[model samples]
Target: MAGLSTPKQKISALIITYNEMGYIEKCIDSVSFADEIIVVDSYSKDGTYEYLMNHPKVKVIQNPFENFTAQKSFTLKQASNDWILFLDADEVVSKALQMEIVETINNPNACEAYWFYRKFMFKNSTLNFSGWQTDKNHRLFRKSKAQFTDRKIVHETLEVDGKSCILKEKLTHYCYKNYEDYKGKMLRYGQLKAKEDFYKEKHFNYVLMLIKPLWKFFNHYILRLGILDGKKGVTICYLNALGVLERYRELKRLEKKNELAYYLVMP
Candidate 1:
């Protein structure tokens, strides 16, 4: 008698996008190995939604703009498969990663969630340091076992209910195209972080505003060995430090506005 063959495990690739016209096509193509590709777009005006809508392999859903965690949570709910491979619009999964994902999900003893390390790219150059060397996130997982945390606004965190393992293959993240793009992204992240802090009732410290950025620069440029990456390293480290300062500044602004509102209500 012939041995019985196990059924192949189906994987759903989930992506959230907002005006990512330039990178959406390539990102979707890279994840073509997935059984289904679900894209939840935030009403993209840059033609990202239209392209994904027309693509036969993609299932596109349009949602209103919200915080990162909320948007991702909405996307997760649309997946038909138990195994989820969450990807960003600017990120690409290599062939090695595709094979590894397939093999891991097929294994009976595989963990509930898997962390994927990333290779950060700035323009055409691959950044080896500047605190990005150890970049990783839990992108592949069993949907029933994981959900994103509710508090974080900018850098969303996944809360896994079961065991997790890190994958060997890396995802390539085309992070920033130019200086202006990088600046805008960092500033927006800072603003969102400030809103999170405000809701958490966290007090802003002037000392932190002054000292944290300096420490950030030192930590990235020196302690993290960003110096080895040359001028690109310096630029990235400096901008990152500025982003920290911007977060505190925005937080302070929120606090001041709140105080003004309270005084206005006082007769």
Candidate 2:
């Protein structure tokens, strides 16, 4: 007599993309183990949408871009399986991580969500320090037990309703292609942060604007020992500091615009 075999749980891999043609194929390939791959694209002009559409394994959906949380929330609804593996277009799953995910999901007592640490890559180099040393996120979770925090605009956060544990295997995150690419991403994040603050009615502080960036540079470059990474570290620290400055500047601009609008409609 033999014991009954338990069926392995299926997983739906979800990805969000915009102008990610260069990385989407590799990203998709890495998660081939999933039962299905769903991509929510934001009207990419770079043929990324076309590439996804033609892929037999991927189900592509086009949605208007709002915030990171909204875009991810839309993708979550398209999953057919209860177990979801959410990945960014710029990230790739390693073989070990893929195997670990399969094993974890198969267990009857597995946690509701799994956290994956990432190895950051910038310009083909692996970044060891500069505050990126502990980069991690919850990528695998039960769809029913997880939801995106609506208030988070840029750095979207997933709220899991049940237990969670961190996995040992790491995903590789190709963070930036070049200096310009990194700069553009930072600026976009800054603007999004400002928009989030504006909606929350948070006033801009000039003193913090001046102090924060300086502290950011010092924290990452000196306190975090980013100096060991050399020029790449310096560039990252500097750009991130500039992003902090830009966030406050954009917030101030939004405040002024709101004031002008209020004056125009005065009774």
Candidate 3:
């Protein structure tokens, strides 16, 4: 055990979970390299909390359901470790990533906060196409140095106060179990995004409704080589198109209301 580095600073793994019973155990089991693991559960009705109770290193915090940003910030505050590795219930740290975490801490002239390139797995295929492969997330950082941006809606990235490095390791994301789940989540996210647009006076525009979605599909499926993924590729593109259509339709209805309000005020 001579080479076994006990390490000086404590690294805590932080995860925010809801009904993640199915994936929680495996996700926590994979990141056991850390000194402590914190699970902030939103009072799930499933076996998630119970499982965490039985888990050796798992520390469960019961908080009522809140937005993602607030929940994560709250958990970060509870962290006893100097550095925190943020993980989702559905995300798993690969072996390479685990080593990267340890080495990054052991080495800071080397890192401020580390970013992970996610490989989104859809069904049996590791989707290299579909704008997803280009997506990178900040999954590791010092607790005091980074914070999740306070956005009411989804698609938020963690804002770090210092310089960062991109880890060469890939973090596997088991996001969206099946096509139905993917479709449902996309539609829900579209509605949330549309609402944000509505508040910002970003109501229906001819270009957005008609052009932007088509561009997204073409960019992902055609130009991005999603066609290589075949059926899954086509499905991902079509779903993007559909989500856009739904968002546009939602915005269009609000646009008409704005026009009507303007006319009423004029008279």
Candidate 4:
């Protein structure tokens, strides 16, 4: 009894969604290897909930939409197990990744959290370089050591207090449906980012707004060797630059509104 290792630990695969009918099935199927699957839907009107209603292994809960960090944190609390594997609706865990995840949780080492490399695919092409080549996310973690940061609205950070590990297998990300879809998401993300910064009392500087976007394009495309990935690489860099521009524009708009309100009240 003293020499034996601890028993295999079960994992709870957690996903948060809102009107993700198209991608939900594939996402869930990828993580079927997990002991339990918990989906916290934000009242999806597009039949996303109905599809998961009869699943035996899945436990679905309908909750209202909140910020990204809050929604994810709430889902973490609903998990029945200590281990959590968070997945976005549009992403798919490969078979190799599934096996690796099973192995890691079954006999976890000293690490309390693990990071996975994400491979982004657009259309039929997978961009291997475009500054996204090094994209790794902290998805698998022990619930006791991990929590989401509340400071940001768009991209939330997972704070893990213990040692971490990285797996070589990748999680396939079907990020954008089309160029239009990509632009739409960028616009929304930019606005949310601007609001997040504005609420933090970050002042919007006119000079930095113009310089930052241009520098972003140059740094990602030229300095990061994104130029080698060809057309998709260029597109990715350009869109990233555009997102920076939009964020500053939105921030300026909010500042102007507040200034006008102050003047009106003073007179």
Give the number of the best model, judged by TM-score. Answer: 2
The Cα error of candidate 4 at residue 240, in Å, is 1.6
User: In model 3, where do residues sit more than 4 Å from their true spots?
Assistant: 1-7, 249-267
Write candidate 1's Cα lDDT for 1-62 as tens digits.
99999899999999999889778888999999999999999998889988998999999999
True lDDT of residue 99, candidate 1: 96
Q: Rank the candidates by lDDT, best first.
A: 2, 1, 4, 3
TM-score of each predicted structure versus truth = 0.96, 0.98, 0.83, 0.91
Query: Native-vs-model 4 lDDT?
Result: 0.87
Worst lDDT window (10 residues) for model 1? Answer: 176-185
lDDT of 1: 0.92
lDDT for 32 in candidate 4 is 91
Q: Taking the tens digit of each residue's C-alpha lDDT, what string does model 4 give over 1-267?
A: 579877888999999988787688889999898989999999988999999888777899988876788899999999989989999988899999998888888774647999989998876578777677888998999999999999877788899998889987999988756797688777877888888989998878999799998998999899988898788878888888899999999999988998999999995
State in Å the error of residue 89, model 2: 0.7
lDDT of 3 at 7: 50
- Taking every candidate in turn, the Cα RMSD to the unseen true structure, in Å, is 1.3, 0.9, 4.0, 2.3
Ranking by TM-score: 2, 1, 4, 3
Clash totals in order = 0, 0, 0, 0
Please give the lDDT score for candidate 2: 0.93
Model 3 lDDT at residue 86: 87
